[model samples]
Each structure stands twice: as structure tokens, then as C-alpha cells.
Target: MFDFIKTQVIGVTTPTVDFIPTAEDLPAFCARVSNPDNQKNFDTAAGLLKYCMRVGHWSVFDMSNIVIEIEAPRDIARQVLRHSSIKFQEFSQRYAVAQNFVIREARLQDTKNRQNSIDTENNYLQEAWKLKQEQVLNLVRENYQWALDSGIAKECARVILPEGNTMSYMYANGTVRQWITYLKVRDDLGVTQKEHVDLARKIKPAIIAHFPFLEELMEK
Candidate 1:
């Protein structure tokens, strides 16, 4: 059962960001170059970055980039792909067989907001859902394997798998500005799928560790 979320920062424009200026200071540097009067100093760079974010000058943040490898369900991966600005390459089910599935405790659908779900205390419902989910997933896996054994093309055989029946590895690349925007919608907005919210939570710390300056920008 693939009941875990995994995220890794595969690449970054700068490995370390500090007060001293270098390529790591691209966002602040871009902001600085926008005006002839700005001086070269750590304080100035830091101030410029903050000012840019404060005044909605998001373009400056596009100077730096981050690449992340995320392991999640196909459904959650689709959600991440909704941010069109971020580029992505996902594990292709058409080319390879699915090895695992994402199964989790089922939640009651939110009536007030169709896009949301709420945790329920009904043990019987939860147990029944778990049993049905497992049965369906196992049956599909067996069918997929049988199809492959019968020489059916993976591309055609993959059609029987449900969205949650596949675990996808997605490599996503985006500018710091885009990452911030994506996280804001998925993490801070309180409207995203719970699984995606959890995935974003894992990704945020990795980015922050590399670019400490982005910490505040990612928050509400």
C-alpha cells in the first residue's frame, strides 16, 4: 500500500543562500538592477526582496528556480499539474507497469463545499470503505497483471486502473515565484485536496532549507 508521501529537492539554482551576494541572490539582484540608485549590500538585497514581495513585484522571484521529485497518487499528481506554469515529467503508466497504489482512510464528502471532505467518526463506514477500496484495488491489479501476461499493450491495459490505483513519481520544475504561487493555492488556501495539502507540506521544508529567504513568502 502506498500510504506515504515522499518529496525530494533534486535541483536548485543555488545550494546555499546567505547574506553575501552571489548567484544565490538572483531575486534580490534582479530587484537591485531595476534601479540605478540601489547599492550593493546584503541589507539592500534583503530589503529589495522584501519590498518586491510586498509591492506585488513577483517577477523578480522568477530569477531563481527549484526542481522537486514528488511521489504521490495519480489524482494528487493531476492537481499539481493544474498549475500550468510549472513544468513536469511524470512516470508513464503507458510505458511501465504500476507497482503500488495509494489507499487511505475515507472521509465524508463535504456538502457545504463540494470540493472538500470532512473526517467522520463512523467506524462502520470507515471499515466498509477500506474493505471495498482494498478489494477493488487488488482486483484491478490482478487484471492489469493478467493483461500484461497476455501480451496486451501497457498503454491499453492501463485504462482499467482508477486514479487512486497508481502511484506516480513526478519531477516538477518551476521558478521560485511559481513555487510560491503553487504552494499558496495548494497549502495555504484551505481548499485543496487533503492529500495534496500534505504533499505541499512535505515540499515546503525542502525548498526552505535551500532558500531560507522564501520561508515567509510561502506562508499565510
Candidate 2:
């Protein structure tokens, strides 16, 4: 007999956003060039960056760029691609096998907001949903394997995969201005998807760590 009650619940892989080291001081250097009178010193550069951010001089931030690699589910990855300013090179499912599948706790749809959800209070319902989700994912995995075994092309077989499957982008590059905008919008819990918000939260720390000058701007 299938032990639905005792089945181990599958969970989503925690998303990661890592900063690829590059010209960290380039933004400040470019900002300094914008004003020939500006002194050539670390304090002056930091002050210029802060003032630019405060006064909405976003063009200076575009002088330098950051590269990041993201590991997230297909659905969240799609959301990340919606940022037009970011250049991304995603993993090709047509060539590689799709493996990781994310299974998250089910939430009740928000009655007032079409784009939001509210947590469910019923433990039994949550557990039942988890069981069902696991079963469906198991079936999906089996079907995918069967298709491969039957000599179906990976591109064709991948169509049957769910949006919850994990995907990665080895190279995602964007300017500081673009990245700041991306974080401001996606990190808002009131409007953005919970999982995507979590991913944005992870990215912020990396940005601040590399370019400490931007910490005040990031807070705003």
C-alpha cells in the first residue's frame, strides 16, 4: 500500500545569486571623470556615488557593470528575464536533462488581489496537498525518463517538464542602475512572488559586499 501519510515532502532548492568579481571601482572611477574638478581619492569617489544616487543621476551607475550567476526554478527564472536591462544566458534544456523540481507549500489564493496569495491555516489540507504534489512530480519524473528511454529528443521530451524544474544562468550581466531597479521592484514582498523576493534578498548582500559604497542607496 502506498504510504501517503508517511511520504517525505520534497522542497525547493534554495536559489543562489553570486557576484562574479570584476572592476569593482569602475563605477566610482567613471563618476569621478564626469566632474574633472573632483579629487582623485576614495572618499571623493564614495561621496560622488552617494550624491548621484541621491539626486537620481543614474547614468553614472551605468559606467560600471556586475555579473552574476543565478540558480532558480524555471518560473522564477522567467521572472528574472523580464528585466529588459539584464543580459542573460540561461541553461539549455534542449541539450541537458532537466532534473531539479521545486515543491512548495500550497497557499490559498487571495480574494482581493489577483496576484497575491494568503497562507492556509489548515494543516491537514497542507499535508494532503504536499502528498499530491509529490505524487504528481514522481509521475512527471517517470514519464520524462520513459521518453528518454524511448529515444525521444531531449528538446521534445523537455516540453513535458513542469515550470518548477530548476534552471541556471551562468552569466547574467547588468549595470548598477539596472540591478538597483531590479532589486527595488522584486524585493517588495507586497507585490512580488515570495520565492523571487527571497532570491532578490540573496542578491542584495552580494552587491553590498562587493561595492560597499552602494549600501546606503540599496537601503533606499
Specify the poorest-scoring 10-residue window by lDDT in model 1. Answer: 15-24
Task: List per-prediction Cα lDDT, in the order shown.
Answer: 0.81, 0.71
What's model 2's lDDT at 76?
Answer: 80
Off by over 4 Å in 2: 1-24, 37-39, 165-170
Local lDDT at 217 for model 1: 63
- lDDT digits (tens) for residues 85-131 of candidate 1: 99999999889888878667778888888888998889899889879
What TM-score do all the candidates reach, one by one? 0.89, 0.84
TM-score of 1: 0.89
Give the Cα error of residue 166 in candidate 2, in Å. Answer: 4.2
Q: Tens-digit lDDT track for model 2 on 1-220?
A: 1111111111111213232123445566566675656524555566777888889988988876677777777788888899978888788989998876766667788888867878787989888987887888898899999999999999999888878644444456887788889989998885898778878887787777666777877777
Q: Which stretches of candidate 1 lie over 4 Å from their true place?
A: 1-3, 15-24, 34-40
Model 2: per-residue Cα lDDT at residue 1: 17
